[model samples]
Target chain A: MAKNYTKISIETSNDLKPKDETIDFLLNYSKALSVLKSAKVEFELVLN
Target chain B: MQEELITDATLVSSYIKGNESALEILIKRHKQKIYSFIYSKVYDKDVAEDIFQDTFIKVIRTLKKGNYNEEGKFLPWVMRISHNLVIDFFRKNNRLPKFDNSGEFSIFSVLSDTSLNAENSIIKEQVEYDVRRLVDELPEDQKEVLLMRIYNDMSFKEISDKTGVSINTALGRMRYALINLRKIIDKHNIVLTN
Candidate 1:
């Protein structure tokens, strides 16, 4: 009996680009997180 | 200097230091590779997109909390995160990805390498663009079949039905498209590898 082997190549084309909406959503989400983090820091400073 | 030329490590640190746009630069720079990796695993654009978002969100939380200690191996570290999330996706759905070993989902050894730095990514994008341009030089019929098969992920039957051609004809066109693409690549001396 002989074993068979197959090789597959991965395509690195631009066709797999994520939608712009996804990128915008991520930017906004990160911005909101930073805002909340700063707000928390300011509140902590006030408490101190 | 342009922000795009900044190293991923610099961008990561900048983002941690409250520079929001640094993260945007990082994301835009590497989004295609990350998204393509996830899509290769899940084969669903929407799910891959969601996983991409979640991966970045985890990155943000980890960086904000000062937990990201990968020591400048930004892309591989992010790839590892996305890989784990893909595994988690399968685990949640009570399924397993292909190429599992002893009930552990592990593949894509290429993702562990640090070869995909900023320069390499830019070169890869250029190669992709060049390949697409060469594809456009193909005959209209062959290019149509090739795009349908590759980009659209359509089966030969589907392509034939869509293009009102027989399955054999569609397959022939796909084969010729590849042959001609190789010739075009050779003629242009374009190396299509990252």
Candidate 2:
């Protein structure tokens, strides 16, 4: 029996930034969506 | 029942038995993280909200059908559902962001390219693993601010208020987090692509 393996090559870049508009968008969207989801669940439960 | 003390599996079982409050408790417990994971990919409030709702609805439907298997790991299951929904949202919209040669930043570009060759898939997986490991290795304060900002979708002001720090301090922590992550990637020679 032989085991299969995957080979990975690393190419590093210095351009990726931590803080960006995308990050902001994701964070804010998550916060708002989470609140909405919880409310929706509660509402659905009430109707059931 | 003390909802706080109840395990996720127990809450899920209760919900399956028509205990609505159990479902509510489950939602409240994992909502923030699940929502954040979805928004990280979709990055739209309304769409993320829609998908978030749909994810839970699907969860309820599946649970009712006795389909969900990861009883104790409910949050991870929900997160996976939200992630697939986000992908479906992109596919339906036909607006999957691609890597631009001009280098405009979009989180989608970092995810993966449309090409699905085995080699490229392996490389993408490795890159993702490396990046995740680097993030996990970040200092606690830096990682906290980073996750709150990126995963939890919090503003610097909100983070500052929540953590009892000045907004500047919160911003600085995020900045340092990025810089440190960049340094780690450079040191480890990890390559990221779309």
Candidate 3:
């Protein structure tokens, strides 16, 4: 096995969850999710 | 995550049980955000609206019969539709619809005739333009994930599922996307309040 030497940066997982910003362009994305749920068309999953 | 699951499951289940009104409530609940998400990708109001209506229409058909299993993330599922509709829109015209290079979801929604009375308070117009420019500079993959995750407010897991990649890959893409955006902003000497 060839040994390689290089400095590597590593990260440990933490409880830092991303905060949802209200001002980002997607401020209204929740409502989009809602609209998809009540969409007006129906289809068969084409289950094969 | 728990809250989204609960709400998604509730709305989907209600629609499944022969309640048409439930679907209306669902549409009313999501119109702005979904419209915003679709418009972000398509960038034209008429085209976006058509694709949006088509997405929901497909959803309706998906639900009318005993098709949906009700065991999936509803938002992601619908997003899959929006994404597919976007592709169809492109393919139908024999051209791929690439998103605007700027990551900013167009601010046009905020600038309509009624903009003076809206309640959102955050970034100003200049910052929005800067953010959009930075987003536009991203590689397509990173840009797609960022749009889905940030603009669509999808979870990493959801983004991964929708994009057909592993969760770690999705996370990596988003991490790199932010890093690139920072570089772009600094390179351009743009300051965003975000």
Candidate 4:
């Protein structure tokens, strides 16, 4: 994470923001995405 | 501040190097633009949300595989992805009508307005049901953590207390649960959106 990271949210044309559910889902999914990538790196390290 | 000084290219590289929260900052910074782009194309909130999620999924996959080399052009690159996904949504629902080019005009495709109606909503429900069913296939501990966090809306500390584990352990289970769910989705080729 970058230092001094602040949560700056923006809304859409409908005058409504993206749902909290959607934002949470994306953040969680991104964390999971990085996990698999790191796991693969570990696997390759063991292979070599 | 510091975040504003950190460019998208820097965030992209941080995410590739396994800093997950960098991706979160990236998503939050541009979510409004991307979400609005999808919503403008689809004209439906649910459909726009689904496309937004799918766009990030594709972005994460590309970055994880070290295939994202667009230099500092992150916003445009992501906008192009979201645009393609909007097209995919239209293509999937046959919203974009195909005209008959064989001299005669075709009314069938025009009349085939298969937009989000009652029937489409039913299909969407079925897809959600199928996803929940797949969640059952995760390992016991991971499934428990996922159900508690997602379905029950419990915080990690609360989950840790209930599950008799450290907070870090609970978080790990949740992360592994999500990773396994993605693998299951891929193996079953389940398109989460209708």
DockQ, each predicted model: 0.39, 0.02, 0.02, 0.22
Winner of 1 and 3 under DockQ: 1
lDDT of 4 by residue, B1-194 (tens): 78888989988998888888898889888888888877777778888888888888888778877888765499999999999988888888877655665545577745777678997899999998997998899999999999999999999999999999999999999999999999999987888887
Clashing pairs in 1: none
Worst 10 residues of 4 chain B by lDDT: B96-105
Worst 10 residues of 1 chain B by lDDT: B102-111
- List where candidate 3 sits over 4 angstroms from the true fold: A1-48, B1-6, B97-194
* lDDT tens digits by residue: candidate 1, B33-124: 99989989998888998999999988877787777895659999999999999999999987654665554555755346766899899998
Q: For this target, which candidate reaches the highest DockQ against the unseen true structure?
A: 1
TM-score of chain A in every predicted structure: 0.44, 0.40, 0.20, 0.39
Fraction of true interface contacts that also occur in model 1: 0.71
- For this target, which candidate reaches the highest lDDT against the unseen true structure? 1
Full ranking by lDDT? 1, 4, 2, 3
Task: Provide the clash count, candidate 3.
Answer: 18
Candidate 3 per-residue C-alpha lDDT over B87-177 given as tens digits, one digit per residue, 9 for 90 to 100? 8888887545334545445455454574433333345665777787779889999999999999999999899889999999999999999
The lDDT of each candidate is 0.84, 0.71, 0.66, 0.81
Q: Positional deviation of B11 in candidate 1, in angstroms?
A: 0.8
